[model samples]
Target: MRPWTLIVVSALVLAGCTTTTSGLMARSNDTEVKVNNRNLGRDLSLSGLNRAMVGGRLQARAELTSKASGDLYLQYRFVFFDATGKALESATDGWQQLNLAGGERRQISALALTGEAVEFEVAVRRIVDE
Candidate 1:
Protein backbone atom coordinates (compact mmCIF):
# COMPACT_ATOMS: atom_id res chain seq x y z
CA MET A 1 0.00 0.00 0.00
CA ARG A 2 1.11 3.60 -0.59
CA PRO A 3 2.20 5.71 2.43
CA TRP A 4 -0.84 8.01 2.07
CA THR A 5 -3.15 4.99 1.81
CA LEU A 6 -1.58 3.47 4.92
CA ILE A 7 -2.06 6.71 6.83
CA VAL A 8 -5.72 6.87 5.84
CA VAL A 9 -6.29 3.27 6.91
CA SER A 10 -4.65 3.93 10.28
CA ALA A 11 -6.80 6.98 10.79
CA LEU A 12 -9.93 5.01 10.06
CA VAL A 13 -8.92 2.29 12.49
CA LEU A 14 -8.24 4.88 15.20
CA ALA A 15 -11.58 6.52 14.63
CA GLY A 16 -13.38 3.24 15.07
CA CYS A 17 -11.67 2.72 18.42
CA THR A 18 -12.76 6.05 19.79
CA THR A 19 -15.73 6.00 22.14
CA THR A 20 -18.74 8.00 21.02
CA THR A 21 -21.83 8.90 23.02
CA SER A 22 -24.00 9.71 20.01
CA GLY A 23 -26.01 6.50 20.16
CA LEU A 24 -28.67 5.00 22.40
CA MET A 25 -26.18 2.70 24.19
CA ALA A 26 -24.30 5.72 25.54
CA ARG A 27 -25.95 6.46 28.90
CA SER A 28 -25.08 8.49 31.97
CA ASN A 29 -24.44 6.55 35.18
CA ASP A 30 -25.18 9.36 37.55
CA THR A 31 -24.81 8.60 41.28
CA GLU A 32 -25.81 11.94 42.64
CA VAL A 33 -29.34 12.66 43.76
CA LYS A 34 -30.29 16.28 44.29
CA VAL A 35 -33.49 16.68 46.26
CA ASN A 36 -34.75 19.91 47.78
CA ASN A 37 -36.96 18.33 50.39
CA ARG A 38 -34.36 15.96 51.82
CA ASN A 39 -30.67 15.10 51.75
CA LEU A 40 -30.70 11.75 49.98
CA GLY A 41 -26.94 11.62 49.53
CA ARG A 42 -26.39 11.09 53.21
CA ASP A 43 -28.43 7.90 53.33
CA LEU A 44 -28.79 6.60 49.80
CA SER A 45 -26.67 6.37 46.65
CA LEU A 46 -27.48 5.57 43.03
CA SER A 47 -25.33 3.94 40.40
CA GLY A 48 -25.13 1.47 37.53
CA LEU A 49 -27.55 3.16 35.16
CA ASN A 50 -28.11 0.83 32.23
CA ARG A 51 -30.37 0.89 29.19
CA ALA A 52 -31.37 -1.77 26.71
CA MET A 53 -34.05 -2.56 24.13
CA VAL A 54 -36.24 -5.46 25.16
CA GLY A 55 -39.14 -6.62 22.97
CA GLY A 56 -38.89 -3.40 20.97
CA ARG A 57 -39.26 -1.31 24.12
CA LEU A 58 -36.63 0.58 26.05
CA GLN A 59 -35.74 -0.79 29.49
CA ALA A 60 -33.67 0.81 32.21
CA ARG A 61 -32.04 -0.48 35.37
CA ALA A 62 -30.44 1.29 38.28
CA GLU A 63 -28.61 0.12 41.37
CA LEU A 64 -29.51 1.75 44.65
CA THR A 65 -27.55 1.27 47.88
CA SER A 66 -28.22 2.33 51.38
CA LYS A 67 -25.38 4.19 53.07
CA ALA A 68 -27.10 4.70 56.37
CA SER A 69 -26.65 2.45 59.38
CA GLY A 70 -30.36 1.87 59.70
CA ASP A 71 -33.08 0.95 57.27
CA LEU A 72 -34.23 3.56 54.82
CA TYR A 73 -37.43 4.04 52.91
CA LEU A 74 -37.22 5.68 49.52
CA GLN A 75 -39.36 6.38 46.50
CA TYR A 76 -38.13 6.21 42.94
CA ARG A 77 -39.51 6.82 39.46
CA PHE A 78 -38.27 6.59 35.88
CA VAL A 79 -38.66 9.54 33.54
CA PHE A 80 -38.43 8.67 29.88
CA PHE A 81 -37.06 10.92 27.17
CA ASP A 82 -36.82 10.88 23.43
CA ALA A 83 -33.73 11.54 21.31
CA THR A 84 -34.46 15.27 21.52
CA GLY A 85 -34.65 15.20 25.36
CA LYS A 86 -38.39 15.74 25.38
CA ALA A 87 -40.30 13.80 28.02
CA LEU A 88 -42.29 10.88 26.71
CA GLU A 89 -45.89 10.26 27.62
CA SER A 90 -46.22 7.25 29.91
CA ALA A 91 -48.84 6.31 32.48
CA THR A 92 -46.52 3.81 34.17
CA ASP A 93 -44.05 6.47 35.28
CA GLY A 94 -45.13 6.57 38.87
CA TRP A 95 -43.36 6.74 42.20
CA GLN A 96 -42.46 3.26 43.48
CA GLN A 97 -41.44 2.56 47.05
CA LEU A 98 -38.16 0.92 48.02
CA ASN A 99 -36.98 -0.43 51.31
CA LEU A 100 -33.27 -0.80 51.90
CA ALA A 101 -31.38 -2.12 54.84
CA GLY A 102 -28.02 -0.83 55.95
CA GLY A 103 -25.25 -1.68 53.50
CA GLU A 104 -27.76 -3.24 51.16
CA ARG A 105 -27.73 -2.89 47.42
CA ARG A 106 -30.75 -3.41 45.20
CA GLN A 107 -31.12 -3.34 41.46
CA ILE A 108 -34.36 -1.92 40.14
CA SER A 109 -35.58 -2.27 36.59
CA ALA A 110 -38.35 -0.49 34.67
CA LEU A 111 -39.68 -1.01 31.17
CA ALA A 112 -40.67 1.98 29.10
CA LEU A 113 -44.39 2.31 28.63
CA THR A 114 -43.95 3.58 25.11
CA GLY A 115 -41.66 2.70 22.27
CA GLU A 116 -40.65 6.34 21.76
CA ALA A 117 -38.58 6.40 24.95
CA VAL A 118 -34.98 5.90 24.01
CA GLU A 119 -33.54 7.17 27.26
CA PHE A 120 -34.46 7.47 30.90
CA GLU A 121 -33.61 9.34 34.08
CA VAL A 122 -34.18 8.01 37.59
CA ALA A 123 -35.37 10.24 40.41
CA VAL A 124 -35.02 9.00 43.98
CA ARG A 125 -35.97 10.60 47.26
CA ARG A 126 -36.55 9.68 50.85
CA ILE A 127 -40.09 8.73 51.77
CA VAL A 128 -41.26 11.23 54.33
CA ASP A 129 -43.52 9.88 57.03
CA GLU A 130 -46.49 12.01 57.89
Candidate 2:
Protein backbone atom coordinates (compact mmCIF):
# COMPACT_ATOMS: atom_id res chain seq x y z
CA MET A 1 0.00 0.00 0.00
CA ARG A 2 1.07 3.60 -0.52
CA PRO A 3 2.70 4.83 2.70
CA TRP A 4 2.06 8.06 4.60
CA THR A 5 4.17 9.78 7.30
CA LEU A 6 3.44 12.05 10.29
CA ILE A 7 5.67 14.07 12.61
CA VAL A 8 5.31 13.70 16.42
CA VAL A 9 6.45 16.27 19.00
CA SER A 10 8.27 14.88 22.00
CA ALA A 11 9.80 15.90 25.20
CA LEU A 12 8.67 12.18 25.70
CA VAL A 13 8.04 9.68 22.87
CA LEU A 14 4.87 7.66 22.49
CA ALA A 15 3.46 4.99 20.15
CA GLY A 16 1.34 4.82 16.90
CA CYS A 17 1.64 4.81 13.08
CA THR A 18 4.03 7.22 11.30
CA THR A 19 7.05 6.94 9.03
CA THR A 20 10.44 8.74 9.04
CA THR A 21 13.16 7.90 6.48
CA SER A 22 16.19 9.43 8.11
CA GLY A 23 17.11 12.00 5.42
CA LEU A 24 13.71 12.00 3.77
CA MET A 25 11.86 14.80 5.56
CA ALA A 26 13.83 17.86 6.64
CA ARG A 27 13.63 19.83 9.90
CA SER A 28 10.00 20.81 10.53
CA ASN A 29 10.09 24.42 11.71
CA ASP A 30 6.33 24.69 11.20
CA THR A 31 5.51 23.10 14.59
CA GLU A 32 6.81 23.52 18.13
CA VAL A 33 6.37 21.56 21.40
CA LYS A 34 5.82 23.31 24.72
CA VAL A 35 4.45 21.99 28.00
CA ASN A 36 1.54 24.29 28.88
CA ASN A 37 1.66 23.25 32.54
CA ARG A 38 5.05 24.63 33.57
CA ASN A 39 8.36 25.94 32.22
CA LEU A 40 8.81 22.53 30.55
CA GLY A 41 7.36 22.66 27.03
CA ARG A 42 6.67 19.91 24.50
CA ASP A 43 3.83 20.12 22.00
CA LEU A 44 1.94 17.34 20.18
CA SER A 45 -0.13 17.82 17.01
CA LEU A 46 -0.60 16.32 13.52
CA SER A 47 1.86 17.36 10.85
CA GLY A 48 3.22 16.13 7.43
CA LEU A 49 0.93 13.16 7.02
CA ASN A 50 -1.78 12.68 4.42
CA ARG A 51 -5.20 11.80 5.95
CA ALA A 52 -3.49 10.51 9.16
CA MET A 53 -2.05 7.02 9.72
CA VAL A 54 -4.15 3.88 10.12
CA GLY A 55 -1.50 1.15 10.07
CA GLY A 56 1.92 0.47 8.62
CA ARG A 57 5.61 0.89 9.41
CA LEU A 58 5.40 4.24 11.18
CA GLN A 59 8.41 6.27 12.19
CA ALA A 60 8.89 9.69 13.81
CA ARG A 61 11.57 12.19 12.80
CA ALA A 62 12.32 14.41 15.76
CA GLU A 63 14.90 17.16 16.22
CA LEU A 64 15.81 17.40 19.89
CA THR A 65 18.32 19.49 21.80
CA SER A 66 19.59 18.21 25.13
CA LYS A 67 19.58 20.52 28.14
CA ALA A 68 22.80 18.84 29.25
CA SER A 69 25.40 16.53 27.77
CA GLY A 70 26.55 13.12 29.17
CA ASP A 71 23.80 10.49 28.90
CA LEU A 72 20.11 11.23 28.21
CA TYR A 73 17.12 9.00 27.53
CA LEU A 74 14.17 9.31 25.14
CA GLN A 75 10.73 7.86 25.81
CA TYR A 76 8.48 6.78 22.91
CA ARG A 77 4.90 5.56 22.53
CA PHE A 78 2.59 4.54 19.64
CA VAL A 79 -1.15 4.38 18.97
CA PHE A 80 -2.91 2.19 16.44
CA PHE A 81 -6.09 2.95 14.49
CA ASP A 82 -8.69 1.26 12.34
CA ALA A 83 -9.85 2.27 8.85
CA THR A 84 -12.83 4.24 10.18
CA GLY A 85 -10.63 6.62 12.18
CA LYS A 86 -11.05 4.82 15.46
CA ALA A 87 -8.39 4.30 18.10
CA LEU A 88 -7.41 0.64 18.23
CA GLU A 89 -4.67 0.36 20.87
CA SER A 90 -1.83 2.40 22.33
CA ALA A 91 1.67 1.23 23.32
CA THR A 92 4.45 3.12 25.11
CA ASP A 93 8.12 2.11 25.02
CA GLY A 94 10.55 2.67 27.85
CA TRP A 95 13.25 5.33 27.94
CA GLN A 96 16.11 4.90 25.46
CA GLN A 97 19.31 6.70 26.39
CA LEU A 98 21.00 8.94 23.85
CA ASN A 99 24.13 11.04 24.16
CA LEU A 100 23.88 14.59 22.82
CA ALA A 101 26.26 17.43 22.14
CA GLY A 102 24.38 19.68 24.56
CA GLY A 103 23.23 21.94 21.70
CA GLU A 104 22.78 19.71 18.68
CA ARG A 105 20.00 18.46 16.49
CA ARG A 106 19.41 14.74 16.95
CA GLN A 107 17.03 12.58 14.90
CA ILE A 108 15.43 9.69 16.79
CA SER A 109 14.12 6.67 14.85
CA ALA A 110 11.63 3.88 15.56
CA LEU A 111 10.32 0.72 13.76
CA ALA A 112 6.77 1.43 14.88
CA LEU A 113 4.22 -1.35 14.38
CA THR A 114 4.58 -4.06 11.83
CA GLY A 115 2.32 -6.54 9.95
CA GLU A 116 -1.29 -5.48 10.71
CA ALA A 117 -0.35 -1.92 11.60
CA VAL A 118 -2.88 -0.01 9.49
CA GLU A 119 -2.32 3.40 11.07
CA PHE A 120 -0.36 4.64 14.11
CA GLU A 121 0.39 7.38 16.69
CA VAL A 122 3.62 8.46 18.46
CA ALA A 123 5.02 10.34 21.53
CA VAL A 124 8.42 11.35 22.96
CA ARG A 125 9.58 12.34 26.47
CA ARG A 126 13.00 13.60 27.51
CA ILE A 127 14.46 11.73 30.48
CA VAL A 128 16.30 13.53 33.26
CA ASP A 129 18.16 10.43 34.41
CA GLU A 130 21.14 11.13 36.57
Candidate 3:
Protein backbone atom coordinates (compact mmCIF):
# COMPACT_ATOMS: atom_id res chain seq x y z
CA MET A 1 0.00 0.00 0.00
CA ARG A 2 1.29 3.50 0.89
CA PRO A 3 4.20 2.12 2.94
CA TRP A 4 5.21 -0.17 0.08
CA THR A 5 5.26 2.78 -2.36
CA LEU A 6 7.59 4.68 -0.01
CA ILE A 7 9.91 1.72 0.27
CA VAL A 8 9.89 1.15 -3.48
CA VAL A 9 10.76 4.77 -4.16
CA SER A 10 13.51 4.74 -1.58
CA ALA A 11 15.01 1.60 -3.07
CA LEU A 12 15.02 3.15 -6.53
CA VAL A 13 16.75 6.27 -5.27
CA LEU A 14 19.45 4.28 -3.52
CA ALA A 15 19.91 2.11 -6.58
CA GLY A 16 20.36 5.19 -8.74
CA CYS A 17 22.93 6.62 -6.35
CA THR A 18 25.13 3.54 -6.58
CA THR A 19 26.11 4.34 -10.16
CA THR A 20 27.76 7.69 -9.34
CA THR A 21 29.32 6.89 -5.98
CA SER A 22 32.46 5.37 -7.42
CA GLY A 23 34.41 8.64 -7.74
CA LEU A 24 32.37 10.88 -5.54
CA MET A 25 34.20 9.88 -2.37
CA ALA A 26 37.66 9.94 -3.86
CA ARG A 27 40.03 12.42 -2.22
CA SER A 28 40.86 15.60 -4.05
CA ASN A 29 44.29 15.70 -5.63
CA ASP A 30 46.93 17.92 -4.06
CA THR A 31 47.86 21.02 -6.04
CA GLU A 32 50.68 23.55 -5.75
CA VAL A 33 49.77 27.06 -6.93
CA LYS A 34 52.59 29.58 -6.57
CA VAL A 35 51.80 32.77 -4.73
CA ASN A 36 53.18 35.98 -6.22
CA ASN A 37 55.77 37.09 -3.69
CA ARG A 38 56.88 40.33 -5.30
CA ASN A 39 53.33 41.68 -5.45
CA LEU A 40 52.82 41.21 -1.72
CA GLY A 41 54.54 43.32 0.92
CA ARG A 42 53.88 44.23 4.52
CA ASP A 43 51.36 46.78 3.21
CA LEU A 44 49.51 44.17 1.20
CA SER A 45 50.66 41.05 2.95
CA LEU A 46 48.61 38.09 4.09
CA SER A 47 48.98 39.51 7.57
CA GLY A 48 46.87 42.44 6.46
CA LEU A 49 44.03 39.96 6.33
CA ASN A 50 44.49 39.27 10.00
CA ARG A 51 44.32 42.93 10.99
CA ALA A 52 41.47 44.13 8.83
CA MET A 53 37.78 43.85 9.65
CA VAL A 54 35.63 42.24 6.96
CA GLY A 55 32.14 43.67 6.56
CA GLY A 56 29.24 41.89 4.83
CA ARG A 57 29.53 38.12 4.38
CA LEU A 58 32.44 36.20 2.94
CA GLN A 59 34.74 38.71 1.22
CA ALA A 60 34.98 38.45 -2.52
CA ARG A 61 38.47 38.12 -3.90
CA ALA A 62 39.73 41.40 -5.40
CA GLU A 63 39.69 41.12 -9.18
CA LEU A 64 40.84 44.45 -10.64
CA THR A 65 43.73 46.91 -10.50
CA SER A 66 43.31 50.69 -10.82
CA LYS A 67 45.31 53.09 -13.05
CA ALA A 68 47.68 50.33 -14.14
CA SER A 69 50.24 51.21 -11.45
CA GLY A 70 51.21 47.58 -10.88
CA ASP A 71 49.51 44.26 -11.44
CA LEU A 72 48.67 41.58 -8.91
CA TYR A 73 48.08 37.98 -9.84
CA LEU A 74 46.18 36.89 -6.79
CA GLN A 75 44.55 33.60 -5.85
CA TYR A 76 42.87 33.18 -2.48
CA ARG A 77 41.84 30.16 -0.42
CA PHE A 78 40.09 30.30 2.92
CA VAL A 79 40.65 28.04 5.96
CA PHE A 80 38.67 28.67 9.10
CA PHE A 81 40.10 28.09 12.57
CA ASP A 82 38.60 28.35 16.00
CA ALA A 83 39.81 30.67 18.75
CA THR A 84 42.23 27.97 19.91
CA GLY A 85 44.03 27.79 16.55
CA LYS A 86 42.67 24.40 15.67
CA ALA A 87 40.87 24.12 12.36
CA LEU A 88 37.21 24.61 13.15
CA GLU A 89 35.62 23.56 9.90
CA SER A 90 36.88 22.48 6.53
CA ALA A 91 36.34 24.07 3.13
CA THR A 92 37.02 22.78 -0.34
CA ASP A 93 40.75 22.67 -1.09
CA GLY A 94 40.78 24.55 -4.34
CA TRP A 95 42.19 27.83 -5.60
CA GLN A 96 40.20 30.77 -6.97
CA GLN A 97 41.42 32.97 -9.85
CA LEU A 98 41.69 36.73 -9.17
CA ASN A 99 43.46 39.54 -10.99
CA LEU A 100 44.22 43.17 -10.14
CA ALA A 101 46.16 45.69 -12.16
CA GLY A 102 49.39 47.07 -10.71
CA GLY A 103 47.91 50.23 -9.16
CA GLU A 104 44.31 49.18 -8.56
CA ARG A 105 44.27 49.20 -4.77
CA ARG A 106 40.98 50.89 -3.93
CA GLN A 107 38.81 47.85 -4.35
CA ILE A 108 37.29 46.31 -1.25
CA SER A 109 37.49 42.59 -1.86
CA ALA A 110 37.48 40.14 1.03
CA LEU A 111 35.37 37.28 2.44
CA ALA A 112 34.28 36.74 6.02
CA LEU A 113 33.94 33.48 7.88
CA THR A 114 30.42 32.22 8.60
CA GLY A 115 30.87 29.95 11.63
CA GLU A 116 32.50 30.34 15.00
CA ALA A 117 35.95 30.00 13.52
CA VAL A 118 37.83 32.99 14.89
CA GLU A 119 41.08 32.65 12.95
CA PHE A 120 41.69 32.45 9.23
CA GLU A 121 44.52 31.98 6.75
CA VAL A 122 44.50 33.34 3.19
CA ALA A 123 47.02 32.47 0.53
CA VAL A 124 47.55 34.97 -2.29
CA ARG A 125 49.34 33.64 -5.33
CA ARG A 126 50.87 35.62 -8.18
CA ILE A 127 49.49 34.31 -11.46
CA VAL A 128 51.82 36.47 -13.56
CA ASP A 129 55.51 37.04 -12.96
CA GLU A 130 56.01 40.25 -10.97
Best by TM-score: 1
| Per-candidate TM-score against the hidden true structure | 0.70, 0.40, 0.42
Q: Provide the RMSD of all predictions against the true structure, rounded to 1 decimal.
A: 14.8, 15.7, 13.7
Give the alpha carbon lDDT tens digit for every residue of 39-92 in model 2: 123222223432223354544445555544443444544454556656554343
The CA lDDT of each predicted structure is 0.74, 0.41, 0.43
Runs off by more than 4 Å, candidate 3: 1-70, 90-93, 106-114, 128-130
Worst 10 residues of 1 by lDDT: 20-29
Q: Candidate 3 lDDT, tens digit per residue, 35-88?
A: 333334421432223223355233333222333455555555565555566654
- Rank by TM-score, descending? 1, 3, 2
Clashing pairs in 1: none
lDDT of 2 at 27: 21
RMSD of 2: 15.7
Error of 2 at 23 (Å): 26
lDDT of 3 at 68: 42
lDDT (0-100) at residue 62 of candidate 3? 25
List the lowest-lDDT window of 10 residues for candidate 2: 21-30
Q: lDDT (0-100) at residue 41 of candidate 2?
A: 31
Candidate 1: RMSD to truth? 14.8
